[model samples]
Target: MKFAALMRSAALVTAVALIPATTATMAQVDGRAGPEFAKLFAVFQRVKASYVEPVEDDVLIRGAIDGMLAALDPHSAYLDGGDLQRLETMIDGNYSGLGLSVVMEDGAVKVVSPFRGSPADNAGIKAGDFITHLDGTLIYGGSLDDAVAQMRGPSGTSIRLTIFRPGRDEPLEVEVTRGVIELEPVTHELGAGNIGVITVNEFSADVGADVFSAWQDIRKEAAGRVNGLVLDLRNNPGGSLDESVALADLFLTEGRIVSQRGRARGETILYDAETHYRGDMAEGVPVIVLINAGSASASEIVAGALQDHRRALVMGERSFGKGSVQSLLPLGPDAALKLTTARYFTPSGKSVQEGGIKPDIAVPQISDPDFALRQKYQTRESDLRGHLINEIGIKDEEMESDSIADPRFQLTADELKDQGVEDFQLHYAMETLRRTTASTVALRPAKR
Candidate 1:
């Protein structure tokens, strides 16, 4: 039987396909790789018979299989049961690192997305850029975990990265200082004009309910009617799929919310509005979903659904474009396979693999004084090596959320600064709602 089939259940899909099945392979030694397997077995026997010290069969076997899977993709890896528990603990609370979401692809370490304000983000490391070397050492064929381990060190120290961005013909070098990554899953506040700003830092557990409570708090804090809402998913590396669906359902009353398609029949599933909630929580209030290159997975799921259903006006830059679903399939009681089982699509059937969800209004963040500095180092999914083909065949330039000159955005960082605007993206979205009536944002039939 196939190794993946050994899993008892495939449940709890995550942003990165983290399946914990047996790291062992079940394929028969009868294909073109048959000769290769024979060589591996022979090497194993030789090592066992004449090694410097005794090496256990399971140790050698696990190493061989791990090496095999490591070559597959960035997200695919073999985690022992202990590693699995450690991962769970990390996800549940704390960790230390340079605060980057990285993956291995095509033998190169790739940055998925640096946490907002992370050392990597501050250093201008964009998504979709290839990290070929670390500290001048070539890491093209290194393990993702090892690379991450090397990147994680005493906070406040710096590391140098040699990056190859697609748009640029030449490679660029960046130096980033490492810092601890503390994930604050959700935070909210009621801004002026009774507009509620909910910043979903990560898609961890209970986020849907948390956002719902945030909305209730926003209404209570408001002196009058809530005018608008801003779902700030910027720099949010997506988490729970169920939370994404539930969050989208907060504003969507009807229609298909999102769907997943996969090779296995079971992986193909449809999620609809009201699957988790009864009615639109913020029925008439204008919702602006803010996304950027860091927004991915569950973040894309929420943005795509609301944009497709016309339930919200997605603003800010394009998302991280991680549309694939990773299911945690249990191999035994302790281990599981976090495998990429399906590609998620918007209600309109648009795949967000390389082509992330484009906002209704493309708003660039020029508010920060260092906006230009940040633009120098940007990355996205399309720039990733071995990134799933969009099939939509989107041009690479479209994926570049880097600042392109637009005359409409004449406001310099100084201008925005003078206006007491700290966040350009959220400020612009709020100003738009203040000027435009909510009726303008109401659901309408697509032009097509």
Candidate 2:
């Protein structure tokens, strides 16, 4: 299809909030800052004149640009060359590599998560793994885009990755064969009790359309009206703002899905149901959204909207709060400015800035033995240095706590295994659907 240039506010923030692209050029430095500029220039002159080795102008300029944006927020950045290309590739969603969503932290390339069935995931790559090297060559201290470019190659090739995983005794190496990554935005699987598990891997272009198609397929396989749904948004770093809104609109017959506010005239906009899709596709079916720390940005938009509207009961851990939106304002042919232009709010007027969407039902995944370890090391938008704080202040405890006590999810990992619950979170969601009537599916004690 069809596509448009949108924002990817990332480093866990990845919702390309929809806004009209402006022809506005970067304004000239103000006369008021002439003194400041002179001082900076003076420093530059001294360095160039007195330093033993000469420093290039491009190097100094790039450093200054990066430094300015870095101090603003973790998401804002100056994009050029490979950085811009990588962003284009994310939106395009088709490439050659062991597919993974990654970010740079403290000068190391960290795995946000592997695409569910990509070569990376197939090779047993897990989220939170720090990729230390590629093919025995150290990649730490390099730019994230450079690391990403090195990992990619033509299909059928193999690359060795040296990973340093937290809670592990030693670093590990994994060999993943290259594959052409076809970024299918949505995937569905029909589980027991006629439960449709629809996973939104990313908010790439036409993700709403993809989910609609997925629902149709699930229903066809179901051979009847699906009783319930589990919208899996786990490990989704995020993508297109239109796709996120469109996806939420599919399940909301009427209501505000999300709203973005910014100082600029173009940044303020509201998305509502029927604005993109006609009506609720899964209107009557009870819905449970699956999210975790990896779920962010556009992921939070959908979860927050559905949760606020009572259209779906959200489950799993707290989402990676990344409510801000980025806008790609072209600086020139070779470079662009990726700026955090707006902050989004949910239907209930709650801002998922540093505090992400909280699931109505807190269900933990006790299936993976590494689950506890992952939680300890899991990163979120709030965890990022220089991340924007919510306008409405929040306490540290609110962001830190995952769950209190819930007897329903009190089952141990071994207990869940005994019940053949390989995926504890999804199983719990589906089981809840099977056991409860849709109207009374609240997060209270189980009814007799």
Task: Give me the displacement of residue 416 in model 1, in angstroms.
Answer: 3.4
TM agreement with the true structure for every prediction? 0.76, 0.90
lDDT of 1 by residue, 1-448 (tens): 3333223122123543334434554333457887887898899999999999999988898888767755554445565554454455445445656777666666788776666667787787766678998899999886676787788788778889899876577899988887777756778988777788999877776788889988988888895489998899997777778778878888776788789888865678898876445678887888889998788889999998888877788998878788888776555556555666788999888999888888888887888554554566666666654566777788867655565677867798888888888788988888887888887865552443
Instruction: Tell me, by TM-score, which candidate is best.
Output: 2
Q: Show model 1 residue runs off by greater than 4 Å.
A: 1-36, 39-63, 81-86, 94-182, 368-377, 397-404, 442-448
Task: Give candidate 1's error at residue 437 in angstroms.
Answer: 0.6
Local distance difference test, each candidate: 0.74, 0.81
RMSD of 2: 4.0
Q: Candidate 2 — worst ten consecutive residues by lDDT sum?
A: 1-10
Worst 10 residues of 1 by lDDT: 4-13
